[model samples]
Target chain A: MLHMLEKTIADNPLITAFAFVGVVIWVSNQIGRHLTGGRVAGSAIAVLGGLALAYWGGAVTGKAKGLADIATFSGLALMGGAMMRDFTIVATASEVHVDEAKKAGWLGVIALLLGTVLPFIIGVLVAWSFGYTDPIALTTIGAGAVTYIVGPVTGAAIGASSDVMALSIATGVVKAIMVMVFTPVFARFMGLSTPQSAMVFGGLAGTVSGVSAGLAATDRKLVPYGALVATFHTGLGCLLGPSVLYLAVKAITW
Target chain B: MVIFGTALLAACYLAGIWVGEAIAVLIGVKANVGGVGIAMIFLIAAQHFLKTKGLFPADTEKGVTFWAMMYIPVVVAMAATQNVVVAIKGGPIALLSAVGSFLLCFGVVALINRSMQRHASPEEADASAALASAPDALKSR
Candidate 1:
């Protein structure tokens, strides 16, 4: 019977993958709500948990794809693939209404630009400080500081190495976790009280999950407002990171 | 009808990937650049077009919501796809870049708020004060 169970799970990889992930999310959510009292977003905890599992999988199998390298979890390869990842991002964007987005006005625009460039500059400086003088590496790492999606996207476009690209993603994930944990703590202090302020905050923060989760915890009403501007950071960062920023870094570092 | 929304998502995704690939090739890059971001823009534009055409009823929206519900799972799945251990062990570069950028960004936010406070009119300040008391009012849907 145990052999049959393993065979069944191994044969239906996608099904097993969904079930496994669902359980992980459920447990993560419980932990977020109970353990951290919702200060830390459940999603952040889940991501950290996923990273740990991936590290464990690497240690266990001495191979990549994290836990999916294990036979029963192999469906994770498909479930976690680019297809599902992009599909989820598209769906999240569908929630934004054009009219609601228009409320951000010029302030949000400035915040968005400042948010993207500020992070990139800081990221580049840090990368430089860490002795990453290669223009591609600096830009990629800096872009990753903009957002995780943007980081990997920029790194891939600029022909960064696998190591640098992975660091870019990790850096972005760390930024997301930072936004998640800090938004509520600084909400009132930062004057994140109005829809417009939420929009500006989102623009400054520049991570959909981070801004949305932070705002949701701070004020469920502000989720859409903050998320609206934060959503654009992905495209804006992607557009700017590998092109303008890359050139700027090369010129300065050259 | 809801399935149609799912199909729309898939359609936008494929289109986004196509455009992303095209952009990558144009830029002499060997990989997709903004596929995910472009796909998002496509979804938003396509959905808006459908709504303007009165074709995107609430039922179709449900299909989109189904994928939305799977968000947490997919995010975990996506995060799992990357190998963080290898990245972090590469050095302190990743952690430092993230933390440094984050601190600066947070400080900028605080500075922006302070600047805005100085520039705010009395009525605007009163509005912010009122907003602080009643957050639910911000839900301008």
Candidate 2:
């Protein structure tokens, strides 16, 4: 069992990336909290750290197809940030005291679980609709989006700054793992020559979604609305991300 | 924006106290801690507005209770994440980092508090000293 586990981890680049990102997020949050006296500051720092990591990873990997992909990722991040800001306002406006609010303890838990898991289910359904046999790419992307975006947004809405940082780390780890595991799977699914590159793009999409969600949760009003906006933003980003990669490859070849 | 909001809230609360005092005199109301009480209410309300009511329970009293709940999740998450990172990084490094971070932040806050205390007028200091001492009496009793 130990040998098998080790092999699985070694073979799975996504898992390694996930672990790396998680560590980075956790450390950054701790540092930010110590410095800022608030979760908002910690979260902001984590987002900035994530961006730096992405840039470093891209450069180190030497797989970046072009400058356009980086620009696209940055643009997506800005859009996501704007969407989150709107969500924060709405969530803030709707704030209520815990005692007066109806406690949906178990129901709330169920709702949370459903919210986190539904994206993957939906992604699989979409992939099936598109006649894709392997749902790995969609699943990875969906999971990344849900975990990163919803976890932080809800954390903030509920005033869970520490949770936001922790969740961000967890989501980052998950996304990294997804990138490693699904890269080859997605390449095969799409009949692409470079599967690893596709995985990286998918990971980028997840990070973008997470950052967007974090920004939205900084204020209460942003929750539900931010989620909707993120969905659209990520959807478009995922579609365009690959196209940008293709153009980069073509440009390089020319 | 957040810093500005915090400052604005503080100003409004102070203004509320001044206004409350004027109203008290105009209506021939009792003096003493009543003005302070009115000020506190205004301060709490302002905090509620600044932090947003959504961050707390709907029925929460506008005071420490609200702040406690608001900060609980943040603390828990931070502690958990910090622990996880430390565990991952192994023993000594993680321990040092966590302890160091805490001490560093604590020292900074302590220094600020000390500076404020030193700058306070004698009368203000005496009142604050009495207030501080009063808490011990209540606790002992």
Q: Write the per-residue lDDT of candidate 1 for residues A144-241, one digit (tens) a residue.
A: 89988777667766777755766787788888888888888888778876766787788999987788888888888778767778877877787677
DockQ, per-model, please? Answer: 0.48, 0.01
TM-score of chain A of 2: 0.28
In candidate 2, what are the lDDT values of residues B34-110, reduced to their tens digit?
22223334544555664564544324223333332222222222222221331232223212322232223223323
Q: What interface root-mean-square deviation (Å) does model 1 yield?
A: 3.5
lDDT of 2 at B75: 23
TM match of model 2 to true structure = 0.22
Clash pairs, candidate 1, are none
Angstrom error at residue A101, model 2: 16
List, residue by residue over A1-254, the lDDT tens digit for candidate 2. Answer: 99887666556633443454455567767875575343233443554455444444345443331111333223222222312222222222122222211222232233233333333344334333434342223333223234343333323222222312332334433442332233233323332221111111222223323323332333322222222222322222222222222223224434
In candidate 1, how many Å is residue A35 off? 1.2
Looking at candidate 1 chain A, the ten consecutive residues that score lowest on lDDT are A96-105
Off by over 4 Å in 2: A1-41, A44-48, A60-104, A125-132, A149-254, B1-141
lDDT of each: 0.77, 0.33
